[model samples]
Target: MGDVIPAPEAPRIPIIDNDEAAARRFPVRRIYCVGRNFADHAREMGAAAPAGKADRGLPTFFLKPADTIVVDGQVPYPPGTTELHHEVELVVALGADAPPGELAPERAGALVYGYALGLDLTRRDLQAAAKAKGLPWDTGKSFDFAAPVGALVPAAALGDLAGRSIALAVNGEIRQHASLDDLIWSVPEILHELSKLYALRAGDLVFMGTPAGVGPLRPGDSFQATLDGLPPLSGRILPALA
Candidate 1:
């Protein structure tokens, strides 16, 4: 027999769902985010919007730990920020089909397992401070319960991508709305770009960025996020610890 190795504890795999198929839990590996993929949102955030395919540059990338996913509906208002913001996005879940590294854009779709709606919650004050000091956005972004996602709907079940709409509402009032076509970088393109950077693999989730109208979220605020035919995600901001 081989030598036995001891470990402190078993790793806890973060899980989402394959829609109502609760028996099949989608274990999350890592969370990859594409920043400013929506031209309107980029402009709103004081960045230049790409006018066409030729002028469109590489997608901005960032990461949030997989455990940040909040599936249970109640999201605690995070600490260290007076300005907490919400950015709803179309999330793409990858399967185990693709070999790691350097995937071509045209063939990237083959790696998709499903899609879901997610909220990319942000601490805007921290983000702005970091930006002013030319620092990384980890403090503003990656935090406890930073990514709240809905169930994953298989890629095979999705209809034409061009026919989808992504929107968000706070307390029943619409704050952001946009057609999927508005994304500067499509899903496949994002995967290809990401694969070039990381060894993109199964259980990876990509937040395809958000549209204009990202705004503040406070305690007791309830929000709803919807993607054309996928499951909608709704959550309430719980009061912060005193």
Candidate 2:
């Protein structure tokens, strides 16, 4: 008889709410983020913004571990960086898988479960250094407790995102603001583009992208991210644990 291998401890799967009532649970699977989806933000980052649909390029995708999600509003200041930046973004949650192969943008909207506010915390100094050396941004963007998301509202309940606004405030001052209409790549387009590279599945989260006002956070700073008609995501930066 073959002996069974002893398994280690079960990993924690972070759960997010699917509705304002918090009755349903949505376990996070993978976190996929789009880089520079906002034209203004692209320009601010020193990359040229696409002039029109013809010139618009593909969305840049990156990932962070599912465990990095922080729902409790407590963000410990990550170590190894003097500059921690806050990028407020709209978070999209998938409820179902798309058909195999390239997902058509027109059909991608059906897979959406809900939307939420999210903060894409970044280690700016590390990111800048990596960019200068033409290196990957894993260390700069993917770290412990790097994503703080708010409770989600069902997509059907929220209706169209056409007139919505996303904004972030730091210590009571507005830091980033933009309209959903300003996105270079819409939600459907992002999902469609992402499907070409990876299989689209349920429980996947996509951070749509941030606006132009990316800035720093200190140990004691507090931040708030908001998307029109949805509950705001708020958290404080505490000194890193020893």
Model 1 per-residue lDDT tens digits across residues 1-80: 76488633311223344444554667788899999999999999999999899999788999998888888768888889
User: Can you give the lDDT of residue 230 in candidate 1?
Assistant: 83
- The Cα error of candidate 2 at residue 46, in Å, is 1.0
Tell me the TM-score of model 2.
0.92
Give the per-residue lDDT of model 2 (tens digit) for 1-242.
Answer: 65498644321223344433646667777899999999999999999999988999788999988888888779999999999999999999998988989999999999999888899999999999999999997999999999898887788888899989999999999999999999999999999999999998888999999999999999899988888888888889999989
The lowest-lDDT stretch of 10 consecutive residues in candidate 2 is: 7-16
Model 1 has an lDDT value of 0.87
Models 1 onward score TM values of: 0.91, 0.92
lDDT at 31 for candidate 2?
A: 93
lDDT of each: 0.87, 0.89
Question: How much does each candidate deviate from the true structure in C-alpha RMSD?
Answer: 3.2, 2.8
Candidate with top lDDT is 2
